[model samples]
Every structure is written in C-alpha cells, then in structure tokens.
Target: MNFEVVLTCAVTGAGDTTGRSKHVPVTPEEIARDAVEAARAGASVVHLHVRDPQTGKGSRDPALFRETVDRVRQSGVDVVINLTAGMGGDWTPAKDDWAMPGPGTDMIGPDERLAHVRDCLPEICSLDCGTLNFGNDDTIYISTPPILRRMAALVREWGVKPELEVFDLGHIRFAKAMLAEGLLADPPMFQLCLGIPWGADQTVETMAAMKAQLPPGASWAGFGISRMQMPMAAAAVALGGNVRVGLEDNLFLGRGVLATNAQLVEQAREIIERMGARVLSPQEARNRLHLRGADA
Candidate 1:
C-alpha cells in the first residue's frame, strides 16, 4: 500500500458530459474557478480540458485554453497543472464515404494537438499511448506509434512531463517501448485510465494487472469512471498507486447527487486518510513526479 499518494482532480474533460450536468464547467472562467477550488480542497494536481463556452462541447481552441490556464496561474493556487494533449485524435469515418472523415471526426496533426502545451507550458501533459475503438461505435481514437513518437519528442523538448495514458495491455506495451526508446523524461509518470467503454474495465483486477506492468520506479495513478470512481481510488491506494477524481470522470457524489470538483477532491482525500495513507501536497507530488512547476 502507498502511504504517500498524489490526488489529481480532472476538473473538466473533453467528453459529451456537459449536457448531462450543469455542474460541468463550460466557460473559461468556470473552468478556472473549479480548478482552483479543487486545488484548495486538497488536490495535488488538476487535469484540464477546455470547452466551447457557447455550445458546451469539447474544444481545442488555444485561445480558450490560454484564458483558462492563465486564470488558474494568476489565482495563486498551488497545484500542478496538467493539460490534455489527448484532443484532436478522434476519427469517425463517414457512413457512406469511409474514405473521408465524418461529422464527429476531429483529427489534426501532432504539432497542432500540442499547441496548448507549447503555449501554456504546464507542469504535465497527457499522451494517450495508443489508438483504440472509443465508445461502442465505429469511431476510433487515432494515435499511431509514429505520431506518438513525434509528439513525445516535441513534449520533451518543451520540458513538460508527459503523463502517459494507458487504456489497455497493448497500450502499456507501447509505453514501455517508448521508455526504452528514451523519449520520455526520467522517472516517467503514468495514468491508468480505466472503465471507459470498450477500454479496460473498471475493476480492481485490471488496475492491479496494469499497475504490475508499469516500469520500475515509475509514478502512476489510476481512475475509474462514473459509479466506480471512489471505489477505484481506494483500490489504487491499496495497490501502491495514486488516485484521481473529479467531474471529468464522474459527476455524482452519490446515487443522485451532482458533484462539484472540490467535493470530489474532498471525498478522495477522506478515502486516502481513512486507508492510513496521506494525500501528497502539490510540492510533494512534483518531487515524486520530477516536475518543475511555474513557480520553480
């Protein structure tokens, strides 16, 4: 069991969740407020994803990203900022014309995907390890090995820690290969994303198995979606890994209660303390992940 754990609150995600909950931050002002609140509530880090304020859909606008991140940084909150580099990879082929991208397809080049990271220079950014059939449809999230290699190189050059996101066993294999190739920074960080549709199930067995495959001395965290969120936090801590929580992966604090990001962070902290493990502060988390914050 891990006595020291870093709790990350994924404040807002690039998902179809905005319509489900009004609590989901849509505007840059709201996103920044939730991020600061999560940090103040004992989250060591905040994983951020901007949205279209007018439509409440996932967006990759650098201007929106800039506004949200700048507000958080200027808020004087002590939290590790983790931007999502997982956008611009969705590819839904047209029904009649499979050769062309469909309406939901949001494909872009690697450099364009990393535009926010290059501009914001957050302490950590995510790199989805591989491509997989997202959801229960023909839509596939595209992240080829070649594209990953190029993005990894650029993120390294920018001096931001890449939180390698692994969805399955094969993703873990590719992550290990990237480590062998010396593309990632020393003491790499990983986030075991579980319980997404068609990805790894939200079960302790899968979390344990994925945690076992991680590189030695690597820092890792695990999170489950929807109802399994808190359970996965306890499970991850028991298995010697960190935990993540917040509106990104879950919206309910209970069976019918909608949750805010701060509430989720508070709940996660309570769980960690109850397990005889203490939640790490942002500075402590940075020390473990070898992250250099903006203040540093």
Candidate 2:
C-alpha cells in the first residue's frame, strides 16, 4: 500500500441535504468556518460549494464564492481550496412536455457554469467529465462532451488545475480522451465519485475498475457517499489513490450519529494512519495536485 495519502474535505455540496440535517453549512460564513475547522482537523484540501442563504439550496453565485474563499484565506489556515464548477447543470424535464426543461431546472452554458471559477480563481476547480442521470425522477445532470472540452480548455487557460470528476466508466473514458487531446495539464488530477443513485455504485470492484481506467501518471482520489465514505478512503489508498470525506457526502460518523466536517476529517486521518500511511499536508498536497499557491 502507498504510504502517502491526501485527504480532502468536501465542506458543503450543492445537494438538498441541508434540510435533512441541520449540521450542513448554509451561509458563506458558515461554510468558510466549517472549512477552517476541517483544515484544523487534518484535511489538506477543502472542496467548496456555496448555497443560497435563504433556501439552503445550491447556487453558482460568484459573490458567495468570493466571500467564502476570502474568509478561508484570511483564517491563516493552509488548506488548498477546491471550488466546484458543477452547479448550473441540473435539468428537470417539464411534465407537460418531456423534451422541455421544467421548473427547478438550473441549466446554463459551460462558460456560465465556470464563471465563478474564473472570478474566484481558486487553486482547483472541478470539471465534471460527463453527463449522467442525476437524482430521482426526471432530473438529468447535463454535461455534454463539447461542454466538457470547452470547460477543460478554459480551466487550463486560467492556470487552475481541473479536478476531473468521474461518476461512471464512460466519464473515465471521456476524461482519458480529454487528456489525450491535451486538454488537461501534466499529472492529470481526478476525483472518482461513487454511490450516488444512477451513477457508479459503491463497491471495491467498481472503485478498482475506475482507478484502472485513469490515464498514465495520474493523481487521483475517490469518494463514496454516506456509510461508504471511510471505507472508500481506505480502498482508495489501498489502490494507490487519495481519499475524500465530509458532511457533503455523509452526515453520520456511525449508526445514529451526526458528524461534522471536522469529525469526518479526523476519522479519515485516523484511518490513513492505521493503514500505515501518512496523510499529506496542505503544501504537499498542493504540489502533488499541481495547485497554485496563494501567491500564484
């Protein structure tokens, strides 16, 4: 097993889980504070997503991102910031017309989806590789090939590392194709997202298959939602990959337990250590992932 691992804390996602659990951060200040806490608890990276303060729903507002990043940076913490460019892509088809997008659809162009990244200029931004059947019912997460290519190019131009997020085998294939086309920079970075309904299932076989599909000399991490979070962290490290954990993917530490982002990071750190592995510091993680520092 590889002895070095990097743990990323997904502070808050664009999911509707805020109502499901009160522990989910809602406002920009809360999210930033939670990120700082996670960093203090041993997360080298903080994966961020802003929410609409009023409704606790996910948003792509640049102002929200700016505030959150500023707060985290000013806290004197050394965590690498990884902002999400995965919003503004949810599409729920209309009941009247199966073809037309219905209410609650947050569809936008690739450029629009990445506008926050351009504005915030975080060290890392996510580039969801392919579209998938997201959520229950008619909601479809749309990330077309052309859109992905455009986003990848834009990320490269901005000099920000794109964390290629793959949810299935097809997404991994597309990620390889992008790398082959020279869209991704050297030491391509990836995030294998598992356990969401309609996407890749959470299993050792699935994780191994996805890891095997990465391009040569890639730096990657894998995350599993809910109860699989810590288990996948071990699995990922065992497979020569990094790990991610947080309240975004899971809210519970165990049965009948509610976990904060800091608790999740602490647990991941413990697991990494017990496996005879050392967790990467923020600086080391930045170097491994090719992320630009604050001065950059």
Candidate 3:
C-alpha cells in the first residue's frame, strides 16, 4: 500500500469531552487557536464543531460557527477546514411514556441540521450517512434514509464536499446507495468513525471490512475514539487509508498523560512517518479530496 497519508485533527467534537479533559477547546478563539496549533503540528485538515461559550456544551448555532471559522481563517494557516453538519440529530427517549422528547433530545430536520454549514460554507462538511443506537441509554441517533438523502442533496447543492461519515457497516452501505443515486459528487470522501458506543467496534478486522466496502476510487479516512486512536491510525495507514486524531477522540498522550490537539497530531505524524508514510500537506490534501481553496 502507498503511504501518502493525510492527517485530520478533529478540533472540538460535539461531545461532553470538554469536561473530561481540560485540553478540549471550548471557546471559539480557543478552538481556532487549537486548529492552528494542529496545523503547525502537521495536520493537513481540521474538523471543527463549535460549542456554546457560556455552557461549554455542543451547539448548532450558526453565529458560533461564524466566529470559529473566522478565527481559524484569520490565523492564516494552510489547514483545510471541515465543519460538522452532524449536529441537531441527537434523540433522547421520552420520559413521560415515550410520547415526547426527553431531557437531551435535540433532533431536527436535515435543513436545520445543515444550517451552519450552509451559512459558513467551509471547504468540507460532514454528512452522517446513517443512524444507530448512540451513547449509554435511551439515546438514538436519528439519521433515517430520507433525512440522509435530503442532507446529501443539500450538501451537493451548496458546493461543499460532503465527508460521508459512517459509524457502522450499514452506514457504509447507505453511503454507497447515495453515491449510486448521484447525490454525492465525484471522488466521494468518507470518514469511518470507530469505537463509538453501539457503533462499529474498533478492531483491525472491522476497519479492514469497512475500508473494503468503500466505493471504487473513493478517498477515505478513519478515526477511533479513546484508547483506539493510535492503533487505528496505524491500521488506517496499513490499509491504504488516511488517518485522523485529536482531543475530541482521545484525551491522553499516554496513560494519565493529558494531551492537547496539537500533541495528538504530532504523535499521529510521527506514527505515519515511522510506518514509511509521508504525511500530506494542506494543499496536497485539498487536491486529493477535491476541496475548495481558501479563497474559494
């Protein structure tokens, strides 16, 4: 397998990881700074998800996205910006006899979910291809086929590269169907999300299976949460795929060693290099992924 790998740093995920690790970027300024740092540390791309400034929780607010993107652009880094269009899909079961939404449900239509991406128009935006049982209890990620189709169509219309995100085998199948329907543009890109609870297991076998399922000529990357990050990085490279890492997926440089996003990116770059792989620069990644230029 060729070793031309591209590293993507997930700057701040829409999870409760901030509270778990103080290194997780919270404010827009902090997130942007982290993105620049990750670029300096050898990440060609930065996947961003903005949080509410006051509460430090995940948010779908377009203004928050505006501030975060503006800050990252002003930093003058060459890293490609990948905004999250995966929010507003959380669904918590109803407490009062399953008739209404419970405490943490934030489900909404596809358009509402992609509002930030439409407004910001980042170089790339994620499109979750399918839904599954997410998190601990009573939570179901509600990405039905119709919703995914609508989101994919919208993403294509907006002239943004949709990073098809797959958390399980079924999601990959769904993504392929979308491709067959001409919803996704040419040379489709995918992100295999591993180790999420009730999702695909973070094993070498699973990664290989998912990678093999991608459409012919597809450009793809993979990430694993928590302790699986480094192993999955190596696995992806070994399987002729790209890799991603960041505090959003893991909090430690090692056991009990707190890590920043830059630290994680640096580690990933080292691993890729040691595996006889050359890490792609931002421009190279842009070309490989068919992403728009900074000025575009």
Candidate 4:
C-alpha cells in the first residue's frame, strides 16, 4: 500500500454538471477560485477544463484557458496545474447520415485540440489513451492511435507530462506500445479512469487489474465516478497507487448533498489519512511523478 498519495482535484469537468449543482464553476474566475480552494484544502494537483461562460458548455477556447490558469497562478497557490487535453474529440454522427457529423460533434485535428494546452502550458495534461463510446449515446470519443501518437509527441516537445488516461485494458496495451515506440517520456504517469460508462467498471478488482499492467517506473492514480468515488480512492491507495477526487467525477458529498471542489478534496484527504497514508503536497507530488517541477 502507498504510504504517500498524490491527490488531484478535478475542479470542473466539461460535463453537464453545472445544471445539477451550482457549485460547478463555469466562468474563469469561479474556476480559478475553486481550484485554489481545493489546493488549500489539500489537493496536490488541480485538473481543469474550460467552459463557455455564456452557455455553460465545454469549450476549446484558448483565451478562457489562459485567463483561468493566470488567475490560479496569481493566487500564490502552490499546486500542479493539469489541463484536460481530452476535449475537441467528440463525434456524434447524424441520425440520418452515418457519414455526417451530428449536433454534438466537435471533432478537430490534434493541433486544434492542443491549442489551449499550448497556450496555458500546464505542467501536465491528460491524454486519453483510446477511443470510447463515452456514454450510452451515439457519441464516440475519437482518439485513434495516430492521433494519440501526435498528441504524445506534441506534449513531449513542450516538456509537459501527459497523464496517460487508460480507460480499459486495450487502452493500456496501446499506451504500452507508445512507450515502446519512444513516444512517451520516461517514468510515465497514468490515471486509471474507472466507472465511466462503457469503459472500465468501478471495482477493486478492475483497478487492481489495471494497476498491475502499468509499466515499470510509472506513477499512477485511480478514480471512480458518482457514488463510487471515495471507495475507489481508498482502493487506489491500498493498491499502492495515488488518488483523485473532485466534482469532475462526482457531484455529491453524500446522498442528496451537492459538493464543492474543496469538500471533495477534504473528504479524499481524510480517507487517505484515516488509512494511515498522507497526501503529498504540490512539490512532493511533482518530484514523485518526475514532473518539470512547480516552476515549469
């Protein structure tokens, strides 16, 4: 079991959680505030995804990313910033025409997708290791092998660590291929995402299976969504991995109770501490994960 954990708080995901809970930050100011508060509450890293303030929908705007990241940096907070490079890959085909893009389709080239990552230059960014059926809907997240290779190369050039987000066993296999091809950096960082629909299930068995497949000299974390968030956090720590928790993956602190980013971080920190493990600080996490450091 891991005695020290790297706790990440995904303050605001690009999901439809804003309507369910007013605590989901939409504007840049709110996002920055929540991220800083989560850091103060014991989050070593803050994962961010910018949203369209006017519509409360996920956006790929570079300006929004810049302002939000600037606010967080200016707050004098010491936390690793992790931006979501998983956007701009949604592909929902039109009902009548399989070849035509649908209303929810927002597909773009790898460069266009990483524009915000280029602008913000976060210390780390997520790289979804494979495509998924995302939800029960007709939407499919299109992260093909070629696309992922290009993205991995781009982030490596920028000296930004790509958090290899593997959602299933196949994703893990392909990520390993990337490693073999010298596309990824040494001491790879991974996030075993669980409980998302049509991907890996949320269970200790599933996390263990995924964790066992990680490459040597790898730093990894695991998280589940909804009600399984805390359980998965505990499971990750027990499995000698780190933990992640926040409104991105879960919206409730308890039944019928909405949660803020800070509350979620506190809850996860409490769980780690109660299990006789301590959450790492930003600098500690950076060194453990072999990141470019806080200044980077």
Q: Which one wins on lDDT? A: 4
Instruction: Provide the RMSD of all predictions against the true structure, rounded to 1 decimal.
Output: 1.3, 1.4, 1.5, 1.2
lDDT of 2 by residue, 70-110 (tens): 99999998889999999988899899998998998998999
lDDT of 4 by residue, 1-296 (tens): 99999999998999898999999999999999999999999999999998999999988899999999999999999999999999989999999999999899999989888999998899999999999998998999999999999999999999999999999999999999999999999889999999998999999999999988999888999999999999999999999999999999999999999999999999999999999999999999988888886435
User: lDDT per residue, candidate 1, 1-296, as tens digits?
Assistant: 99999999999898889888889999999999999999999999999999999888889999999999999999998899999999999999999999999889999999999999999999999999999889998889999999999999999999999999999999989988988999987788889999988889999999999998998998899999999999999999999999999999999999999999999999999999999999989999988888885235
Candidate order (lDDT):
4, 1, 2, 3
Q: Which regions of candidate 2 deviate over 4 angstroms?
A: 294-296
Candidate 1 overall lDDT versus native: 0.93
Give residue 182's error in model 2 in angstroms.
1.1
- Please give the lDDT score at residue 18 for candidate 4: 90
lDDT values for all models: 0.93, 0.91, 0.90, 0.94
Clashes of 3: 0
Error of model 2, residue 169, in angstroms: 0.8
The reply for model 4, stretches above 4 Å from the true place, is 294-296
Prediction-by-prediction clash tally: 0, 0, 0, 0
Residue 74 of model 1, lDDT score: 97
Q: Compared to the true structure, candidate 4 yields what TM-score?
A: 0.98
Error of 2 at 212 (Å): 0.9
TM-score quality measure for candidate 1: 0.98
Alpha carbon deviation, residue 100, candidate 2 (Å): 1.4
lDDT tens digits by residue: candidate 3, 54-101: 999999999999999998888878789999988988888678768788
